[model samples]
Target chain A: MRGTPRLVAALCTVVVALLLQVTVFPHLAWNGVVPDLVLLAVVGAALVTDARFATLLGFGAGLLLDVAPPADHAAGRWALALLVVGYVVGRVAHDHQPGGQRPSYPVMLAAGAAGAFVGTSLFALSGLVLRDPAVGVGELLEVVLAAVAYDVLAAVVVVPATVWLFTREPGPRPAQVTPRLPRRTPV
Target chain B: MSLDTRPPRQRPVRQVSTPRERLEASGMPSRSLLVALVLACVALMVVDLSGGKDSPIAPVRRVVGEVIGPAQAAVSEVMGPIVGLPGALRTNDALRDDLAVAKDRNADLEAELERAGYNDNRYDEFAGMCQMIGDLGYAVSPAHVIGYGSAQSFSDTVTIDAGSDAGLRPDMTVLNNDGLVGRVLAVTSETATVLLIIDPASTVGGRVGDNMENGMVDGQGGFEADRPLELRLLDNTVVPQKGQAVVTWGSEGGAPYVSGVPIGEVSKTFEELRLGTFRAVLEPYVDFTSLGLVGVVVPAGDDQRVIAADCVPGGTR
Candidate 1:
């Protein structure tokens, strides 16, 4: 997937993930923490797209999360958190396989856990700096642990599906057709 | 046929171009872009923090609410029954037992009412008595919980289907059937964000049972099913026992909270010896986990108050 189509697909994936994050997942919360589906979606995009594009996607997604109704915290906390997640994930994945191949399952899972940890920690630290009444040492530890565990659990499904969506060829083609190459003559 | 053939030709072209070439082709430097975005995020946070409630970020939040709020409400409506099925099944037996207990209580209440010679006049007298006993009467607009805040954030908040169009504004008290839920923090045309009472940042002035001792109720951060609120009374000498009810002391005009709204009950008490302070833990009557329909208390107008005074036993003739 080249430029415009890939961007559109990434946008759609993030929006859907955000919808699930705010609406459906709250009902299925485990121990008062819902899986960070939007963060996982950013990780998925990072795995499939370049660092620059993934970072942009993460910024947009995080801004939406920040401003979305029911969000009471200062704006841009999630934006910063996810921006780092996208950049780090994209860079690591790119370096791991410069050929643009899909990462292995374990790699994807690790990226998800790492992304969750980075995002949650950044958000929590910023909250502490801002003197946000919600963040304390104990709460921070609990949130970080729960967020990483949930993101990793969700990554098993969300990451692979997102990668396939982004990397899959746009149109169907003949399975076994190979174009003949002109014979190279010594000059 | 032409569209089908295009993908095959494009595939080889894409395969031939390496990731490095593609990155260079995209033009902008990746590291700089990241830096710029990070700076932008930091600026937004700074602005939001400095500006407080009337922040420039309000418009952005309102736009997001208008755009995403409807979608969330739609998804919630469509998915609510399906998602609730398992919990409903698990609680079915418990619900039946509750129904039996409620029926018995209803009969006893009805008999008591009969013995007291219940009538429309008596009902009006009771309402007058309640007002005399310091009931801050406020009309309520009902709404449904459409969405919740991202669980990653430490603050507890929920989006309700009602908003400014429904006469909801910031700081309005919100409550459910059980007890006080929270207060409105922001409102759009069709939705409002409520900061739940259980959020650590939340502090509600409360009155304790019988003597109506004054205290400040503080939220204890995360809303685990069994977590309790911390209440610090102004006077440290008075010790509250377990099961003493708590109610809001109400603001001056009840902008954020109204008087006579039940908050919770004391579950335990603790005294800090060194600080010489008294504190109690309260289990809130409102279940933070499973909020559904709730009412946003709108200060009643004079006409509404008159109507309230004229309220009959069942229906007005």
Candidate 2:
């Protein structure tokens, strides 16, 4: 956690995932479906790292996602969604795992599912409620499918690499138990 | 070495104090996460039910947004060349569908142009219209939008190339191929900013031909959102329906906006007990998103003269 190289890698990972979310992911729609790579990464981070680390990553990812094209909602919506997703995932994962060693594929996948649900639901609801933009059920379902698919795939490959990365040095200390006001919004 | 050998550095920064404290310290909500979620939801509902008025919360959101917008714009710019790659990778079937749609749209446009008799007046129309309109004592100046207005504001605004050098003035109405675009908001020698009527802050007097109940057209969507605007009937006696050609009543008013400028038609109308009026939203004639060549109405005779004084000291110039 203290190593500069690892910190940079995590930062780069978050950026790359967010870049994909904004630039490439939305464009890669199949029958009007696109992946939520940022959400996947947040869940992926929570699965391996502690709540503190996950929350930070979420803030960054959320910020990037907010700025992207098709960004048609309240600003903090994505950040808030990602932060909540990461925290909830990290806490629940810790609870289920108990020992809290490196995360396994199942744990990462579970975290991914939960994160996607929370992220997409909050994002859509913000648009529907706060903005009063009329959206249909079909569009929401499409986002859900995309998020789930992206999460499943990301968890398959990224979790192992993250586990190795964390195990290489040392993992985050432990879940912070209490949430922080967070200087920056977590991606 | 024991796994517990290392001592803590600076006591871990007290990262996550407690969920409640975290929520409270943020100055947003100090409660259980569930409570916070409920509060946010309730706030959202209140904002939504308030009938989509522009609120002060946008600047707060924009502050958060401004931090990341530039980076996203940069990435979008960088990815410009990479855009067409994915489209090219589409299957033949999808390509055929796209081709068919394009062809259909092309045919429809061609027919419309033919019907409008653009071929007959292609060369003479602008010059002739310019002369005809100028003889009527209206100074016409041309303008083009160079770029978008402020990104933080959801209202559609554009910066035009013509300004005071062309004798442009504030409140000068702007029009495009379709209809009224907006009125000039700010101006300089080289450029002038026009606030599109689609913005929530913009209010224009609208009355369809002889409807007698010339209602007020207010921007439907709030500041941070992009949605079709609404035109509510200020006078409750008349209810407006969809597809009604809503035009500016320049025929009646000597106002600079002109009476007959085509605003959007009635897109939505509803009666709510709270508002107690038939509120209808109009879809503007000019598609603000893709506006290009536009006309600026500079100060012209009676139109310009009436504003200062109806006296007309020396009579007709």
Candidate 3:
């Protein structure tokens, strides 16, 4: 709702997600696949927010990740993927309430899975278009599968929490009841 | 009856949509905004893909790295001990096993040393390296591997701790005790990304042992353990010899690599049906898989030292 608070919450979520993705996830990797916590956060944020904000969040988060270490490909590839993913998730899982409504867990989970798949696929496509030697079709498919699975699993915890935090607007209030005046002393 | 008169006189009211209702009607992210953002992202992607290292986002990338590098280093420091606990125990066990074997070897070496009057074979290794440094007249700086490239991209790169700060520059040759490792791809303030010779994009001019038959050694894009590198003979005049050693053919300026640096030994040969050229699969001397402490070749300042007279092969002593 408010600009400063929204910005603060977004920054905090993205930073925490980025830190965890880069630092902690590498150690937790299985089959060389680590959950993309940043993408999960973006989906969660998008689920509670609008498409515009979600797209912006995705772009910003993706940019940070691209520039960060261990990122071997050209920059902006991830940003494009994340931007598209954010927009898609925001549109798909959108809950438009005068008072914002957080998406249900199942919705969040599906959205997270879908977002990761789309994001990784887009990244792979961009790499392929650039003639990157690394982006083989089989490898890309495996990566997409792993990323989606991991994102969904992690989203079970992170998505709900992020949606709850971002969905700050209060729900609709009950109708007010006016008190009846006493029968004018039986007049 | 008196209140009814005023109530009846109430004017007709107009209903106005709330902000939320209006937003719902307008839809999330107007088409124009979405189009603008998409176009912007496309522009960025195009620029980044084509711009190489001189892209406009280079500064942004550098700044982000500088900010995040310290944080990552701190995280690595804090988490290293915890994450490495199990590995450390395993290493302890391995060391014990190695120690037993080393003790027997030590005894055998001691007996040999008593007969030959020398004990440390390691001395010869270092002496050879010293001789090499003297011969090549290139300053060598040792560095340790800090990180590997992202698995998702399957990039054949390793980050070394020594960088521009250590007088290491891009395209400089990297080596270990065995032989040529790779060349420095990019250097930051504190780290450098080394593109190993086993990378698909990597190609080096190489010559077969002694006969000095020139060829091009290319990476097979193979990551499997100890995959043999491919060397294609250029002249096609000489017969392919098995187990022949391959060394750098040397560049004009010795920027990326110098001549006489051993690459590998011929393992297998293949004849391309179309090209009629023989491609030899050479097993590289340096194990690209398990890289450890490595040396970067920097330029040696003017130092009056003849190229080890023995190295010149029958030239003036």
Candidate 4:
């Protein structure tokens, strides 16, 4: 995959993941915490794409989550958290395998868990600093644990699928020309 | 028959062509750019926090809501049943148990209604809102729950299909069939954001029982049947009893909440040694988890006569 196409695909994946995160995931919440699909998408993008692209993608996706309906927290909280997640995940994953080989499932899952923890903690800590009415010190621990667990479980399926989509080669095109048969008009 | 059909296998070769190419392919972002983006995020949060209701971020939030709100509503409508199947099945037995309890409550309400001589026409109205609306004479705009939960925060909120266009405004009280749901926090053209009362940050002024003892009700974060709202009576000497009905104490002009709306029933009572005041736990009537249709109380226009003017000795207005 080339640069522009990969960027477009990554953007679409993040948007779709965000939609699922806010809509479907809420219904499937475990212990009042929904899996951060957008974060997982960023981690997946980090594993396959360069650090720069993943970081920007993370910022944009996080901003969307922050501003999306039903969100009452300060804007940019997720953006800051996810930007860091993207940068760390992309740099670590890229450095770990200079050969550009696709990371194994365990490696990808570990990255997802790490990204989840980093993103969720950063967001929570900022909420605490801001004195966000919604963030209680006692509840913060439960939220962080549930968010990381759910993201890791979701990462098992989401990360590998994202990697395949981002890295898969285009299919061969059909032949555009036909061979000419010799003319037999003289006979 | 001589068409070339071999698979392209030069991808590896292209990747490893040169060290410079490998470095370029690695796609590591420059530290300066990361720092710049991080700084930008912090600035945004700062501006948003200090700006309050008129924050510059409100426009951005509104734009995002307008763009993505419909997609969320569509996904919620189409996928709600399918995704909720497992949960529905899990709660099926619990719902069966509730049926018996509901039957008993129904009997009690029916006898009360008989004694009160309530109108039959009011019974046809949807949910618990109709009864409250009838009793209180509140004008309410009905709306459907389109989405739930914030993507990254622990705030308990829901997006409803109605918005400013539907006469909804921030600070308006929202209720469902069962009881008080929450209050509208923000409104766009076609959708509104509601902050649920079950959120830890929420506090509502409540009046307990016929004595109408005033108290402050605080949410305990999450909504579980066992987790109830904590109520602290203003008068330290009076102790509220179990089974006492708690209702909203109505805000002035009713911007955030109206008076006489049933909030919950006192489940247990205990003395708070620290405050030396009697406190009680109230199990809210509305179930926050399975919210669907809800009503936003729209204050009646000045030109219209207040229907419940005589009900309260002093009018809410």
Candidate 5:
């Protein structure tokens, strides 16, 4: 409930970051891949939120990211796929894990990495199939792997810090219980 | 369980719904991701599958594109300073060489101008068209690009710093660095939004330079990957191939957009297709991902007549 605007802002940041990752980072590329800020943000959002919010976050991030390189055209596909991934991560974590315990850092990392890998791969695959039938699956897969690994490593810290910031509970819980219901509190 | 103080469960309301439950609750198949994705996939498939003709999602794509386009443009703008340095340095060396060569060429041209015919320094073929434009009584007000598609889009259109105050109007042609970028779609007080030819929703009347073959250059802006902006040629009867030039017809007496300006060269030719007929791809003359200067053509009188004429049976003039 409190995260809508923040989530929107994060989505905008992720989109801008991803666009930078594709266009400018090449000038600063390490091994032909750029760090994916969108992945970190998506994973971070999903780690502490429900599926609906996570989906919304992923959609915003994906649509923004697709604008990078000025070439990728399937904007909706990225939005839909990332939404699926984030929603799944949120749903699976909530269903399997016990309450109040955060998923292990490595598990979250792996999940984030895997989702980015799949999402990026699906994009390349879509590009190859829909745009040019000349691209082979293997070449695209390599790029996907590189992008995923780079994003996971770079996002390791950012993701956790953001999740910690947003998910942290700062005050005493909203006093969920009392010995007896007070008739009324004095003004 | 604290005996004295315990919060009652708020109806044990499932705090976070399961993925499957969420999907079901959200109308899984049709409205859920699977269907939405399927529809997207189908749409993309249909566009590529049909080669960008007859797909109805083009307008929807343009809307989505406008959202992403601004961000894309912004990132590119921020990256400009750093990325441009190397290119600028290289250009410096190249320009120095070109300067020496240009000096000799200029000297030769001056001598040639005195000895032979150099008249007004305009190309012969274009001379007629230029004169034609003047004869039409058009008031040409050039504009420059103040903004572009950032990380949000790599679309070819741009925002000119001019607007109605600058005498710019809706549907006026915009150009610079290339032939046709797009027509002015929205105008404000001091600025106007020009829908570039690369926008998925953009459709412009264009012709081939060599053979005078005419067709419509429909936007393939968001159609494919790696091809940021593209245009299609219709009118199956017009024959041209990968190297033929594209330009606007300059019909409205050369008011909106003048004749013979370079739009793009045809890259991919759809030779094996038909349905109302031709096949052509416009490789935009302007590199939209990188643009610095542009011009907006001042609108002529009764501009809506052109829009009306665009729908006539025989197509544009």
Candidate 6:
């Protein structure tokens, strides 16, 4: 029950992000590479959620990407890659201690960059393994670097906001204290 | 002994594990569950990679596509007008310049018409006849591009709003004003997917210029923004020269592409001495990066109007 609202919000975010990824991002592509907003969202989700949840989210997100139009590769390659990403990011997130604490900007940026690198690498590897490798190693490396840089930059803004929005539990209002009135001098 | 002044040193207590601790030790949120999901995904991948269109995943993919395709179409429809604004503005500027020239031409044409005493009705009829003759050979349906491939792996395709509802079918040739764009790959009730000629998997039988030398034009996966397509000649007797026009050698009755449609121009020619054949790199006529209004070439039936030979004076067939 507690996860319902967050899950809905996450789903909305995923839909919007996927839409933008297919539409507006193509216009903003640099060197034929657009930032993976969904991957960034997945990483953000992982930071705020448990490993199992992250894994599930990753599979769902990757599945959406796989089935989407213009998808040429085998289905589930992205799912596998992103599943690994979500689980690893979630596990790594546990290292920073006390749950529910918002990650700092630097930490979020690192996570985003690392997640993008890992996710893109795994995607490329999966492609090579499951399908024909249309791109070479050098190109693959370039794609990974571009994706990481772009994701890091995006994460700098998106991660903190997402963590605050989804992960942080509101603190209880400070216990209100009613101070005792000074004993009226026996009036 | 019963009332010892000093209390015995407290012994260290061994920690007892709680249910939660046990759950955490076994990997909370279910490690086995995650593993099962992963294995399922792997199995799906194996099935998908091993099978072609008939794979179980294809229908699932199609169903999922139908779910998202409409949303994408709506977004593209909204975005289309906005994306065109810049070009529209540029065109407006150009139109202003052309307007004065057009006015001058109009005045001249008016004077000529007065001198010639042109019959408006007869001229309209003649123009209609000419247009009818022009459309008799072929018919085209206009379509709007709804979306482009989101991932690099599938970068060579685009989705269009018009589909079987608009008479689109698989292998129908699509073209822009510039030249050949691609062929229809798949279609649903209201939408179709086109595999752009620039895709790596695409191969078009091409003929070079007036020499009519046959060759194959293949897409290079658009690896670099600079180079979009590649070409390889088949015959050794005649060599394809640089800057020669490349046109579709075409298919039977032009099912995939119409005969003699412009594909591209040769950019560079490479000689393979060992294979005794030449390869030509091409600069495609169509700028695939920015796609707009496209036309689907469909076969026109025998109901076309043919002009009478007697209509032309001093003209012989």
Best by lDDT: 4
lDDT of each: 0.82, 0.65, 0.78, 0.82, 0.62, 0.75
Clash count per candidate = 0, 21, 0, 1, 15, 0
Could you give the candidate ranking by TM-score, starting with the highest?
Answer: 1, 4, 3, 6, 5, 2
Q: What is the interface RMSD of each candidate, in Å?
A: 2.3, 7.0, 1.8, 1.7, 5.5, 2.6
Every model's DockQ: 0.34, 0.06, 0.32, 0.45, 0.10, 0.27
Contacts from the true interface found in each model, as a fraction, amount to 0.67, 0.06, 0.48, 0.83, 0.16, 0.48
Candidate 5 local accuracy as lDDT?
Answer: 0.62
Worst 10 residues of 2 chain B by lDDT: B305-314
Give the alpha carbon lDDT tens digit for every residue of B149-216 in model 1: 98799789999999888778999998865778999999999999999988989999998977889999
Instruction: Give me the candidate number with maximum DockQ.
Output: 4
List runs of model 2 lying over 4 Å from the truth: A2-12, A52-64, A67-70, A98-100, A129-131, A154-167, A170-187, B1-317
| Colliding residue pairs in candidate 3 | none
Candidate 3 lDDT by residue in tens digits, B1-317:
35554555455586588776666563477667668777777788778768878888788878877877787788878888888887767676789999999999999988887867332433443354445555556556767778888757666889999878777789988876578888899999899999888888899889997688899988866567455589988876566688999988888788787777789999888888798889888899887777776767776543222222233322312
**Which of the two candidates, 1 or 3, achieves a greater TM-score against the reference?**
1
For residues A1-187, write the lDDT of model 4, one tens digit per residue. Answer: 6567887797789889988888777778888799999999999888887777889989988988899887999899999999989888888877777545688888888989999999999999989988875667779978898889988999999988888887776668766888788787985
Better of 3 and 6 by DockQ: 3
Candidate 5 segments whose C-alpha is farther than 4 A from its true place: A1-10, A16-19, A22-24, A67-69, A98-104, A128-133, A168-187, B1-34, B37-41, B44-317
Candidate 6: fraction of native contacts reproduced = 0.48
CAPRI quality level assigned to candidate 2 from its DockQ score: incorrect
| Candidate scoring better on DockQ of 1 and 5 | 1
lDDT of 1 at A122: 88
TM-score of candidate 4 chain B vs. the reference? 0.55
Q: Per-residue lDDT for A99-180 in model 2, tens only?
A: 4467766766666677777888877776665654576868776776776676666557655565556546555667667866
**If chain B of candidate 3 is superposed on the true chain B, what is its TM-score?**
0.54
TM-score of chain A of each: 0.90, 0.75, 0.85, 0.88, 0.73, 0.85
Error of 3 at B106 (Å): 7.4
